[model samples]
Target: MKSSRKGLEICCGITATFLIVVALVFTTLWFTTFKPKEPEITAYPVGLEDINVFSIFFVRNITLNMTITINNHRNVGSFEFKNATAYVNYRGGVVAEVPIGQNLVPARGKLNTTTSADLMVGKIITNPVFFDDVAAGSLNLTATAALHGKVRLFEFVKIRATALSTCDISFSIASRNVQSTCKSKIKL
Candidate 1:
């Protein structure tokens, strides 16, 4: 009976040590190989697709074209974006909303997406600041994009992430030129 008890204790000790070693190995691997990295996002104004400012009393329309770029920096993970949306605003008012749909960005890859916004020209022109900006020969707009998705590591592990990007675009009406500045962030 004494010998049997000693053997049982030895087996428990070995099993405990084995479990500790396996946990340490997995922790090290997680830190070194499976951690998710933030992605870079940028927006560029492609052109003004259409603009109608013919009359002061008549309703007008404006269509703006733009492109968004997503750069994934991770070497071992890919991103899957689902049900994203991009919004265009003018002087604190939302002018348009564009759907980005779904996309998959491979590891260390870049994705360029394009969108078009149909501005609510009737609403925009009614604002007091609209005439002032038109007189100045430029229009200032803001573009915001929200992406909700998951970062997949290997084939089975997925981490939920949300990415947001905002850009300030200045359009020169006379020359049809565009200048923009953008900022981006990601949360996991």
Candidate 2:
């Protein structure tokens, strides 16, 4: 009986030690493997909020509305966007630069923002090819956006990334319609 009791005591101690070591290893791995993931952001033209054209003068003022969607996946923490802007590019040239403003995106959540751009349609007419593209029923343009923000990881690790993306956009000049295509390479 005495021998059996001692052997049992030894087994219990070894088991406890093994369990504690396993727990320690797991805890270390948990924190070490955890990191902040880059947030997902996308922007696309939605429609024309306002369009006014004077037939006699051929001057036009247009308000283009775009939808900016952000997805902060879990483990990425929170994002506090300072400023966002989109530059309308035509054939590798910048025609218009619009500030989209700032907002916040929660962790593991999604945010939708509406950005507007005031455009001088008459000025765009200066480019014959641009006018042709618009008259063709689909005005194809590239939207290059810069997002300046800070990412908070577990409310502790804070890092800022100036992310920029080039996205293809299409608008129906005949109607107040817009379509968004996929984004190109994102630069940091």
Candidate 3:
């Protein structure tokens, strides 16, 4: 028939050019070995706001105002803050452990930072009062950061405390196991 129809049109154009070069080498090896994984969060995400100690006779050096609320649950990117380590406790010990100059929390939004510590109210205990099981007395702020380079991302970044969330003390003590570890007053 003309040479078998030109050998069946050159074998269908060499099998459609070898299936388009094997589909472009499997789409360039799946876009260069398929990459898209970089997120290994470090730490720092424990918030619950409201922490005011501007005055309570805390002499020698007093100034502590903490208003927290931060969240950055990294999924595949976003991370910073090469330094931070703040821990101010009470009743359970650890009065202070500050070192959060601030900076770093923008991968998923929800930011708010205002930390300052310099208390010396005689190491608080005289006019002390935070006896809500020593724990619910709140204000256990703990921060630790250093997520600048890695690839594990966040699973659930956190940061709580939403403005004077508690502790509105007003005690004039009278002794006799007098406890006032206030931590349940959120009017603002």
Candidate 4:
């Protein structure tokens, strides 16, 4: 009777071991066939084209103007520029950094915007003013555009999110010193 009991115990142990092995194999197969994939990310650089100082005038005690235009050539997702900030310098001297415009850029397309600021310009002479010392000037513009949404993933899926893109550039200001000078002296 004792030997019979021992044989039954061994059989039970072997059956339990076989069941555990089968369970492990099934779990492995399930995980390998049903796990989610990681997200795919792609980013492109921004470029500038036809950047110009659109207009310059004194608007309510400030020398205000609209400046900057950009061309985005991104092949994926949506690109939007909500606002932009840039700076201008006169002969390497920091002059101003003004906020441009609160504009929107369509998804996967191009856009143009403006940056406006108020400045203090005091002229020394108004009537036939003959000034001699007029130096050179430079402008360094930087812009930030907020990007949202995502492009078609693998020709089927769509991944969406919000991100930001920034651009910095420097260029020479042409004919900046020879502009019309009034009789007021600049107090800067």
Candidate 5:
């Protein structure tokens, strides 16, 4: 009876190992066969194409206007973005970082959203040189947005994509004319 029990334990161990190996192989094949597309993201200052609010500085208050456009390029499932944040930079100095809650962008369609950052002119304009530059007008701004999201395949398989976008904006306070260009990338 002791020998029989030892044999039964060995058999169970071997069976478990075989099942684990099979499961690993199946998972490998599944990932190699299935591919999920990354979502497309674009960001820019709102209404820059025509006439729009780029940045307004009045007294000690400053308001920056921007928009982020997200497109779920895949046909399968909706892309959900969490912990989205936007940063505005002036000459490599980060002025503000705005928190944009969670968003679920529909597949094949697009989500056009707007976010604004209110900054204090006194705090950001610390040095006299920077203040002089702003007083002269023609401020160049660089804005960046990062989002963490995931796309699911076959209901259970989830693919994570980190979307990043950078925008270069040129706004003339004196001229009231603004122009910007942005490029987006996704890391899977």
Candidate 6:
């Protein structure tokens, strides 16, 4: 009976040691290979598709095209984004909202999606700041985009994360030139 008890104790010890080793291995792997990371997002203005302004008081119509790029820097994870919308704001008011469809970005990959914003004449003319910016020869606008999705790691571990991007656009009405600066953030 004593020998049997010793054997049982030895088995338990071995099992505990094995579990500790396995846990250590997994912890190391997680820190080195499977950790979550934020994606880099950037926005570029493709061009002004159409711009029509009647004097400094009225904007007949305006259309702006833009490209959004999502870069996944992780070596072991992929991002699956759901349907989202991008908004264009003048001063503090939203002028355009564009839908960005679902997208999948593979590991260590980049995705470029294109969207267009059509500014309504009524929305622009109602804002008194629009006239001031137009009279100054430039239109200052802000473009915002949010991507909500899951990051799949090792085909099993999925983490919910949201990537938000905002870009400040300065458009020259006379030269048709666009200058933009963008910033991005991620929430996990």
Q: In terms of TM-score, which candidate is strongest?
A: 6
**Quality of model 2 by C-alpha lDDT:** 0.68
Better of 4 and 5 by lDDT: 5
Pairs of residues clashing in candidate 2: none
TM-score of every candidate? 0.76, 0.67, 0.22, 0.33, 0.63, 0.80
| Candidate 2 Cα outliers beyond 4 Å, as residue runs | 1-38, 49-57, 173-176, 184-188
Runs of candidate 5 with Cα error greater than 4 angstroms are: 1-40, 46-58, 74-77, 127-137
Q: Which candidate, 1 or 2, has the higher TM-score?
A: 1
| Model 6: ten consecutive residues of lowest lDDT | 49-58
Model 1 misplacement above 4 A: 1-33, 49-59, 135-137
Judged by lDDT, which candidate is best? 6
Q: Whole-model lDDT for model 6 versus the true structure?
A: 0.80
Scored by CA lDDT, what does every candidate get? 0.79, 0.68, 0.41, 0.39, 0.68, 0.80
Separate clash counts for every candidate: 0, 0, 19, 10, 0, 0
lDDT order, best first, reads 6, 1, 5, 2, 3, 4
Report the error of model 5 at residue 33, Å. Answer: 11
Better of 3 and 5 by lDDT: 5
Q: Considering TM-score, which of the candidate structures 3 and 5 is the better prediction for this target?
A: 5
lDDT for 73 in candidate 1 is 68
Please provide, for model 5 over 82-165, each residue's C-alpha lDDT reduced to its tens digit, 9 standing for 90 to 100: 977788787667877766778877656788887877655554566446656667876677778777888656567677877777
* Candidate 3 local lDDT, 100-142, one digit each (tens): 5545545545456666556444555442564442333332322
Candidate scoring better on lDDT of 3 and 4: 3
lDDT of 5: 0.68
Candidate ranking under TM-score, highest first, comes to 6, 1, 2, 5, 4, 3
Candidate 4, residues 72-155, lDDT tens digits: the string is: 333333333334454433333334456645554344455554445443222211112212221224443333434343434234
| Candidate 4: residue 131 lDDT (0-100) | 25
